[model samples]
Target: MELESPQRRSTMRDAPWWRPLGPRAPWVAALLMCAVLMSAALFIRSTALESSALVARGMANVIMVAGFEAFRDADGLPDQAALDAFLASHREGGLRYVAVLEEAQPLVSAGAGKVGTRDIQDGSPLRVEGARARLIHRIRRPRPVLGPLTLEETRAMTSVGDVQEPRKPLRMVYEFEPLTALELESRSQRLLGVAVASCVGILALAFAFSRSLAQREALAEELERGRRLAALGTMSAVLAHELRNPLASLKGHAQLLAERVESDTLLAPKAGRVVSEAVRLEQLMNDLLGFVASGELRRVDADPNDVLRAAVETTGSSRVEVRYLPSRTPWPLDAGRLQQALENVLRNAVQASPEGRPVEASVEHQDRSLVFTVKDHGPGIASGEEERIFEPFVTGRLRGVGLGLAITRRIVELHGGSVIARSHAGGGAEFRLIVPARGV
Candidate 1:
């Protein structure tokens, strides 16, 4: 009954900046965490591959230089056996192919079958392609004059009037193994799978936590609303009890005065007005008592159609049309309480409609629940007031106390049912009372 002040309403409307994001904060935090984890995983994988490639390149260069040193014999001539022995010792170190070249001609080579044309291209002397690497080295060839010809001996021979021809350059080509590259890729792919699976698990947990939080908040709001309504009901019951005797006395005195003043034209009209207003106050007191006592229920097996007909009869409006389901089965219900609730809803529908328009009523069974629908050919509920109209002391019209729909909702809830209100497409309002048959 007390209206809210404009200052309090304005303060509520001006909420904090972050209030809009409060409900979605859980999802936002989860997505940000997942993004960070995925980025770290990808960075680590790339770094690991880069480090491995660097190691492979260094090893290939070392093997190429070592092979060139071992290819020469004590007489300063090419030795096939020494080169072959060196390759055999380091084969497990990813040195899959090796070749010695003179003037672009292959002199002696090992593992030549595994080398492809695409593997050897014109590039830097020491280069790496993925997990594989290549290295080229050039070595000097000394002409032999004796069992072992030193650099000084060769120079003396050339200076003593003995001219010598220049020697062709020898080059070594090395190709690292492919198996090492494949193994690295397989390990990285496994790590990627682990990252994806972890993110999925975390997303599931976040969704579950958000859902649980929402349910908890809803229950808390419901408890607070119940507390407030309990206090209001207690005060209402006290006021009704205190006002009843005085109201009855006023109604009786007004009626007696009206009978006595019937011969006087103006006095009779004034006295009648007092009696009518007193009667209206008495009805309000009765409604308050009923609203306060709506929590208790007494269930009995009874026919719902009979209850529907009784409510319609109480409305006593000629413009109302009834459509009842053919089936007549008994359900566990508080006949008196349910009929009272139905009567209130039906009367509201009848009163809201214009004089000539008809109010429609129907009953049906769905999913083991009974549904009672009432539609009035009225202006219908306002855009946002459909829910607020069900609160006690909240009304669209100026006349009468607004306890009818509120009391109806309380009684329906006690019967394990719900009330839904919606504006019909054809310019009216519709209300449905869905009551479960078994659970109550």
Candidate 2:
């Protein structure tokens, strides 16, 4: 029935993998949300860029086709002046160069620099070259022909409308400059950077919020625990008061009965049992009263060694071995209250030891505080019951009501002291009580 350490218990609660992440859970969720948003933004950006590229290419084709049609005559021969004007109008629209080819040769060209020589065939449609985009259209027309007997041919041709032969197709090749892939990629990267920065901000804010929330929860839990303790104290006080009068009357009657039946052996034994039980009940009631009362110390300058010796003698246990190391100055404490606390602890240690085993009690001064220790060479306190032993009505012993150590703790705490229980390295239970030299 040993009580667990507060730190150990808290560690156990957070031991599960998922439980350890509770405080950080909000931050994790926020980061995930940011990731989702960033992914969506990038997806939309990529889609828009792709669609824009398609639309730009479509619009370029339309502009080139319209300009080519406007320059051509009814005979399907391009006007040089009209073609020059069309090229000038689109010069600022990334149109680097324009060329009209006839029979795989340049017929007319307009640009800041010479257009490169490239293989062009009739009926070749739109195509892309390095740093340039091109559209090609073929134009066909009738060609005039002369036969032998020029005067007769002229007269026969004059009688008919006109005699014509098929001519070679003319290839209208229009080349324009287009945006580079590197420039588009740079723009997309800038957008991605902005999204990433926004996500980082979101995560940071989430972590801060989570930290504040965890602190609030801890404070609330502490307040709740204090409220419970205060309520328990009130209830114990009422019960102790209600039971004390009846217990005192019972003890008095039992004592009188034991005296009256002194001569009859059987009757005397029965009366003795009743008296002993009453005494035990009275002691239990006293322990309850002490535990519930608000501890108010009557402070005086006293020697810690003297207090230890007095407590050991009060326990009336011959099995206790006393050790004391005196300090230069006496400490301020409520001597009676401290003696009672020590007596309770010393009694527990002595009771826990076997007949032959000695309980060790020691007192010393360290770090301006009186340090009292009691240890028993017996089965140590059960694991996980070290702290619980100090709690009211919690004990490892079968017959113990468990209020002794609880009362001891209250008295020690009232004097601004602390008590801790642990298993000694040599295999026994050890209790250490530390009281500050200055009174509370």
Candidate 3:
């Protein structure tokens, strides 16, 4: 059977759409949030600026129209002085140029001088460049009022250039910077700050939400693993209790039959096979109990070298080689449990090695931890199976259940340590049991 990483399996079986992103979910969400929020801010800023420009344009037209009517109702022609005064009064409103022209020649003008005849001949009513704007408006004479003329009105009409002077199709040209004229610099700055602040705040919130979701999923998976292990332990206890007596009786009868039928060759071999199978079953039962055992450690000050020696002796493999580096300092550990863990790993290495090949073992102090290593001259663990082989009932061998490494890992972790398996560079599988050298 094929096995995969627990996280990948969990994600495939029952995870949210974003569960596959794992630790990167927050970053991904933050990027997407930034893109959307910045886009919105830019759109709003552009819309507001457009609206402001239109309002400024309308106000300029109103002021210019009022001035034009005033010049028309005066007693004499509006000279350059009057036009200059009109422009200066409205300078704060962004008015840079004002002129009254007849047939492309300036009759009166102020601010940046009169428009060029060539520019006027071009016939474009309005021209805009960056923040500056120019508008050309044709002026119309006010019609005579229906009531009897007042003394001031009659006197004004009787001037040298009378109301009868042929209406000169007069044109007024204006140039100004609308945005700067209306003093929108501060308002634009405030809008920019608000936009930037809004985008950052929203991105932060999105990142937080993503992190919280990932954490919640991780907790749920952890709880599920606890439940499965709890149920397995309960079932293993019940089966061990119920099967022990019958298994013992069967092994006893098989061994007695083998002894009595020694002279009967055929019957003797059959009985021998039965006893061997029973022994194997007994070993299987022992391994099962060891795997489902609790993780509580009983710690004591013990020498690691002594523990390694004991494990090698108990394994009883003549081909096992030791590379012992004795440590002068004693380490805190549960000697019996640690010995058992080492023996399990050593026995597996011995079993996997070729006939007459040696299984190597070593122990040494590195930094703040004690490390025990085992290497077997056998076909190494398959690719991608290094971590999976540590899971309960996951064996790479044709014989025996796969609980040795799992038990070893559990015992090591109880000491606040870890176990890792990898293929040796030369040719074999290597296992390391690294544990803290000091008391927990």
Candidate 4:
């Protein structure tokens, strides 16, 4: 496969808001721009001042080199004779130095009085070809007070060789001024300190701004939630008022038919079933509205055993068994409402239990609280539907409007209690209601 270049890939990844940048990017860019401006200024200054300094240093080196060449050559040094002879033949032109230098060695071959005739020479030139410079002074010999001469000016200067060859090599030296060490250190430290202080300030402001943004987002979210709840409340009130009157009429007609029906006859049996179902539906609607009624609490001390008995009585079944470890326990409850809530849970359990599989009701006192349990043996509810079954208007049965469990939960929560529904160990769902007992 062919590969795309980095530039093309980077362009593809670019998004409008997901800029390859940060909140502080603009501030940092501004700072860098200032540094660039200052750098441009410094560059201009350096170009001007350094150019002048280099010219001045070059001129000084030129003067020093020329004067030193004259003085050094004037002295009677080794190979100086050759330099003088070359000078005599070729007078001063643009030639900056006639470098005739030497060693202090005696030249002899018995027949020729002094075999190597030259004993004097000139020095090499020094110059600053492409740099800043300050070359100064000249020397014929190593001065006792200071040192040997260095001609920086003649570093780029022209030179011509003398006529005679030297018996020994010459020493070469380089020269230039050094930068002041302390001045460089001070400037570097100052720049570093300023950068650090600016970065610290930027980070502190970033933290405060981020925190402020988060708080504003949270407040906006809370306001949105309150608005939604208020709107829902208004709609629910309108819906309940509109539906109740017709529902009452339907219930009345169902009851009239039920009074005239005979249980064994076919037409009457069907009519009786219609009445029973209609009554159940009407009762469910009442529960739905009742669960949402304004008052949430009417706490009172009452026997938990009595509450169980009332729930069983409401079920109107003679077959279901009741069992309790601690039959009587004083529980703080809104007696009438709590009895209705438990009745709803028990009635569902009885319906779900298989024929001849008697539903079991039990009550116990634990940890300063009353625990009531209802168990049934039947085909287990679908796990997926279990939680949804308690949601308003959701049902497992075809005929149900699905408010029983939802109303049960509303009442339990109203009384500062809890309920849990799950499959029982013996084979079916177990619903438990836990409420506080009447005590400190």
Off by over 4 Å in 1: 1-21, 72-84, 101-108, 122-131, 136-171, 178-198, 382-386
TM-scores of the models, in the order given: 0.77, 0.59, 0.70, 0.45
Of candidates 4 and 1, the better by TM-score: 1
Error of 3 at 55 (Å): 3.8
* lDDT over C-alpha atoms for residue 351 of model 4: 88
Cα lDDT tens digits, model 3, 1-440, are 98899997886888678767875777787788778777776776776677667766676677667676658666455678888888888787778888878878987788884577776777876665566677787776445557888999888978776756466677878887775434554476577788788778877887788778778878988798779877877887678768877999999999999999989988999999999999988877777777777777788888888899999999988888897774456888999999989998999999889998899999887878989999998999899988888877778678877878888998898889999999999788999999986553
> Cα lDDT of model 2 overall?
0.77
Ranking by TM-score: 1, 3, 2, 4
TM-score, candidate 3, is 0.70
* Tens-digit lDDT string for candidate 2 (21-111): 7678778778788989799779967976786466447746876676657764534455577668777887766666666665666777776
Q: What's the C-alpha lDDT at position 305 in model 1?
A: 94
Model 2 residue-pair collision total: 9
Q: Candidate 3, residue 267: CA error in Å?
A: 3.1
Q: Candidate 3 at 79: error in angstroms?
A: 5.9
lDDT of 4: 0.60
The Cα error of candidate 3 at residue 290, in Å, is: 1.9
Model 1 residue pairs with clashes: none
Tens digit per residue, CA lDDT, model 1, 193-218: 88889889878887887787677777
